[model samples]
Target: MQVDSDPDWSALLIRVRDHEDKAAFALLFRHFAPRIKAFLRKSGASDTLAEECAQEVMATVWHKAHLFDPSRASVATWVFTIARNRRIDALRKARRPEPEDLPWGPEAEPEQSEALELRQETARLGEALRQLPEKQRALIERAYFGDLSHTEIADETGLPLGTIKSRIRLALERLRHQMS
Candidate 1:
């Protein structure tokens, strides 16, 4: 009897992609589905959501099989990346307010005193931001106002990821002190 200790996952995936082989897809699903569910659960999804997302991710794998490039990523890496992106999408969808939750009429404007207070606070924040060292201030602006992730900031600045995080943290601390 030939032992099937290590089946070639890449070959199976290629079969699914090129030939649309049901047997190969079955093998891939059997191997990856449960692991994907467990990963989603560990990433803070409830059991039901994890199971649903896992199913959807596997379906995605089947549908998007042709897009998978073995040279760029292993089969496991591609599947897990799909799962992670699905989780992020699900979280974003869940956080969005429903249409019914939105106010219907024109929103009321703030009172003059409240608007003045907000302007003063904004000015104070601007001054505090300016007080930070230029390097730290730039990082803060990229991370907050620019809406860039630390990794993206690192890539753009050609700095190490740890340095980006540390500068952002120190800048936040200084801003807090100034605001208080």
Candidate 2:
């Protein structure tokens, strides 16, 4: 019997779940890596950084392929979202002493996950983040999550300092607009 070719990405993910399927992995990597690179570039990553970030995203996909769920999002969307979150994480690492990460003795504040609905609300927040123009989203993610100062951000990103602030200001305004 002849085998069908160019199966859906969801099916490719199923193949990736098989422990020995290196070919499935290569196919998945080839398809998604360019999209990841384009995504990072649009989100204001320099070319070199975009390339490096795409590699990381694909590495993640290879490792996490078992976790792929068609119900959550299309394979492409899942991959891009991972890249987006990674970019934000890279852009905005914590600064100074984080309240939670503080090495306080035994009295540290206990942590808990947000409830299911609240987590969905935060997912809505993510969708809202995606709605903002790419530049605005990138700036806000970098500032809020990466905790970079305006000066440091500008120097690292090569964006004019004023543009950075404006994009962040606009992104926040958009978030409030969408959330309320």
- Which number leads on TM-score? 1
Q: Model 2, 1-180: lDDT tens per residue?
A: 011233466667768776747787788888889877876776567899889988998888878887665544557667866786777765555333323633445633222232223334445676788789988877776764343678889999999998888888888888999878
The local distance difference test score of model 1 is 0.75
**Candidate 1 structure quality by residue, lDDT tens digits, 6-88:** 46576799899999999999999999999988777755678999899999999999899987755445577678678767866
lDDT score for residue 134 of model 1: 96
> What RMSD, rounded to one decimal, does every model reach?
20.2, 10.3
How much does candidate 2 score in TM-score? 0.48
Backbone clash pairs in model 1 (N, Cα, C under 3 Å; residues 3+ apart or in different chains), count: 0
**Cα lDDT computed for each candidate against the true fold:** 0.75, 0.70
| Highest lDDT against the true fold, candidate | 1
- Candidate 2 residues lying further than 4 Å off, grouped into runs, are 1-6, 94-180
**By summed lDDT, which 10 consecutive residues of candidate 1 come out lowest?**
95-104
Residue pairs whose backbone atoms clash in candidate 1: none
